[model samples]
Target: MSDSYPQSALREWRAHMGHPATLVAILGVGLVLGVAGPFGTDVRLTLLPRIAYWLITVLLTYSAGTLCDAMLKRPLARFGFWVHLAVTALATGVAILLVLLVVNYIVYGWLPDRDSLPAFLGTNFAIAIIVSVVLATVHRQSTPVEIVSNPVRILDRLPLDKRGPLVALSVEDHYVRVQTTRAEDLILMRLSDAIAEVGDTKGAQVHRSHWAAFEHVTTARREGDRAILTMNTGTDIPVSRANVAKIKEAGLLP
Candidate 1:
């Protein structure tokens, strides 16, 4: 069950990080760095080597940061906003440093001697923090637009303008109440079927009567042996004892 946390977090991370615009931005930075040279290295290298170096470095750093983001999400969230930022910045910095070390060794046969590794790590680590902070800011600004453009298929039952990012679904007798960021409405359907139709939206049945989208969850709190998901809309949805492990594995609880 614990093993599933990383996988689920990684899936969620990929969903956000795989945006075409993000890829294009990373690629553009790499191209510019390659052409202009990083730390005056391009002046000594040919066009092909310079391009390859920057491209590989950017790709590796991006991948490492994504993985670190997934792994550190829950712990950082539990630690609160400021701590989350600091921890993520530090972890991403170390990851980028390591990636650069390996990439440089492979590409340029430049193995840092033991005496030089500390300075190399420090320099790359600083670069990593700056890059990660910038990327995070960009993603935050672009995310709302992306969410608005990509409508969820499961929300087709709602009116055109009413549909938004899904929040939660509650089963009320024979009908399922669909909650979105914009509003809530009832549609005749079983919770199980609704869960199936939700498709790629990351969510889980927290209780027999309730299903909550991971993205819409603002917090998760424990009550005795059960868990409760506090959604973005400020509604608290209860989690059954049976689903506690499932919710934890989804990284919805810390």
Candidate 2:
């Protein structure tokens, strides 16, 4: 069950993080909030400050949870990526409040009630979801770039200069479309099996259909609450909560 798609899902998320669109998304959220306010109340709510805060806090906490998954499967796996997301959301909410309280107490000598935690986190959660989803959707639509000419490098026995690599070796539907260099070739192997085979190759499976090479990863992007990785091939992959940390610790992320 673990091999089915969670690994590949993790790989895909890592790939979406680098897209310019992802940044635009974060900015767009800020832009909208800057104009409308955090809750979009008629007055200036100014969600940008909170948005920025949670973006950093959430991604860090979420990635940390994902890294834990890399070592062992937990009851958390049963809920799939959503569980990681929930924890991230909760952690971000708590972290933000803690920061605000500490700063306020030190500077202003005031602290809000802990009972208000729900309202505080809820507002930020809504904003994060909105921005993150937009980026994730944009990222999902991008095509994956494949390295076909370099197939020889992937083959264990042959030198890249010697023989042409075999074509049609594997084909798995990918969340990120791949375009091989010499010619586009669909990897004929099962998505799960392919990732397992390359487990030692400095890569992670991000989704059922996405497998990103570690050397090919360029940056990590966050769309509101979701995380994506931008690959060297210029493709975005979705990162499942279950495998986020594994891919990160593998040094697949920047």
Candidate 3:
């Protein structure tokens, strides 16, 4: 589960708060709050306790929200927008509340009472909901970018310079040929293993011997009853008859 969770969380993060601009915005907010201090109290025994506190809180909250987003994605996809938002809010709220409790205890030795816990939880919930909504909007407005920018677990077998936006993977005897935008390399791994390593990159096995990244597909054409995908690098990949319908439903085929 741990192996799959990070990949799932990474995909969700890219879908929402993974943009470079969103990261800049988060850092900017952290800087403002750090200097200003909560409730305008800047008194500190240490050199930068306020700044540290603010930055830590921002990191924790965002991490919790991203994790919850990944965990709830599949289950919530079947529901309406409002239901997704509600579940996300509730889960993120609980995560934030727990994070705040730990952070407060560490930074100020403060613990909430039964009476005070409700108010604290409510405040954290409100903040989480707002952040989630704002980030979701930003994600919607931004242009779709490469989802494979992060280092892939499977690509570690290839040379460092060859790791780039994966174009496709083809089985060659006992080895798999990994084609990235930058370069192509052969690895002594089975196609099935390679596919599992591809993680969250949007792709499907178009043929028994071929899997192509959707983003790298430049054109989709039909050759008789079979489907063909022309990659950006000009490699034409054949799509098996059995997988043609699945690729069409994914909008990778016409």
Query: Which of candidates 2 and 3 reaches a greater lDDT?
Result: 3
By lDDT, is 1 or 2 better?
1
Give the least accurate 10-residue stretch of model 1, judged by summed lDDT: 139-148
Stretches of candidate 3 above 4 Å error?
Answer: 1-6, 11-19, 40-47, 137-238, 242-254
Q: State how far residue 126 of model 3 sits from its true place (Å).
A: 2.3
- Find the candidate with the highest lDDT and give its number: 1
Cα lDDT of all candidates, in order? 0.72, 0.44, 0.71
- What residue pairs are clashing in model 3? none
Residue clash pairs of candidate 1:
none
Question: What C-alpha lDDT does candidate 3 achieve relative to the native structure?
Answer: 0.71
* 162-201: candidate 1 lDDT, tens digit per residue: 4778888887555566777765544555788778767678
Over the stretch 144-189, how does candidate 2's per-residue lDDT look in tens digits? Answer: 3444544333343221221222221223332112322222222223
lDDT of 2 at 100: 47
How well does each candidate superpose onto the true structure, as a TM-score?
A: 0.56, 0.31, 0.53
* lDDT at 47, model 2: 53
In angstroms, give how far residue 69 of model 3 lies from its true place: 1.4
